[model samples]
Target: MTMDGALARIIRSAADRAAAAEPEVCDLCAAPVAEEHPHLYDTGAAEVRCVCRPCSVLFAEDGAGEGRHLLVPRRRLRLPPVDTAVLGVPVGLVFFVPRSDGTVTAQGPSPAGAMRWEVDASAWQRLTATFPQLASMAPEVEALLVNTARGPRAHWIVPIDDCFRMVALVRREWRGLSGGGRVWPAVERFFAELTERP
Candidate 1:
């Protein structure tokens, strides 16, 4: 093939790859983005947004109206001795995150967030009995995940991403009643690793 034709083909191929690798445009502003992009919190809409770097950092500046949508924090904390009653969570395996709004988001066999299976009274009681430190979780962004199998452990205040990952595990891997064998084992392994964190 001619050098000019070859170069033209290569450029087209590169353009196609770039397009495929890019993320969908922001729902609010219609901006283009690369696959991995920063998020924007829209307080007026109470929604999370995928934004270009410029827009994302612009919102991060928190000028007047911009300050309303607080950035989701990235820090993780391993807290000790959380109060269980405040959470009213009854399951040993559960997680909760307080949103900017007063209510909390929870998951698992407990009080709040999203759950794959219902938690009975006994399950709730068993969980709260073992982990009391989860009560101290800061509302919004901070979450408490209790592993009853871990046995009377302190709370680990981690970024909300960690809780979401646990939810993904259960929803994706859990099978019939008791989440079958695979999910429970995976949950245990996750807790074991988290507890070992410094």
Candidate 2:
């Protein structure tokens, strides 16, 4: 066969292999799903979809789906907290976001907007290394939340959506490093919240 024909055959074969790999039921509709299917995130309705390409592309345009729907980013960012040798954050737990504007924004989130702060590379390194997953965090959607309250506690693998909750809890309830009584309760509550999620 000619080169163009060979390439077309190869593409078709790949598509066939993918089709052979799907589960029987559609994850969303429970209608029978073929192995070859597209995945979509409904930004307007906040839904995940296992759809045919036509349905997946329906919402592909900018500001589609009433502007509420956002595709669930398929890519995962691995961001670990970097070390902070300078201006050690008074509290151990802090969330750091490296913004698109080339600014490293740090905060713990409070009732107010993110109680903004910044840290140098050393501190960032210390925190990120402990939580390697933070290194690949998606901008605006996630952050590296680090806890060094009493010499570095275990890092929590949390969703970007949940970082604000951590900040609000820390700001409102934290009294001291032991997080005082108020802080511990909030931490427990946050922990419980994580456990309940799938």
Q: Per-residue lDDT for 1-198 in model 2, tens only?
A: 999999999999889968897555544456666665545444344344566555546656655555444333333233234454343566555666654444466676444435667766565555556655655664443455566654334344444445655766767886655456677667656654453222
The C-alpha stretches of model 2 lying farther than 4 A from their native spots are 1-88, 109-113, 121-132, 150-152, 171-180, 192-198
Candidate 1 lDDT score at position 133: 44
TM-score for each predicted model, relative to the true structure: 0.54, 0.45
The candidate 1 region of ten consecutive residues with least summed lDDT is 110-119
Candidate 1 structure quality by residue, lDDT tens digits, 3-60:
9999999999889979887557865478877776655555566445666776665555
lDDT value for model 1: 0.58
Q: Which prediction has the highest lDDT against the true structure?
A: 1
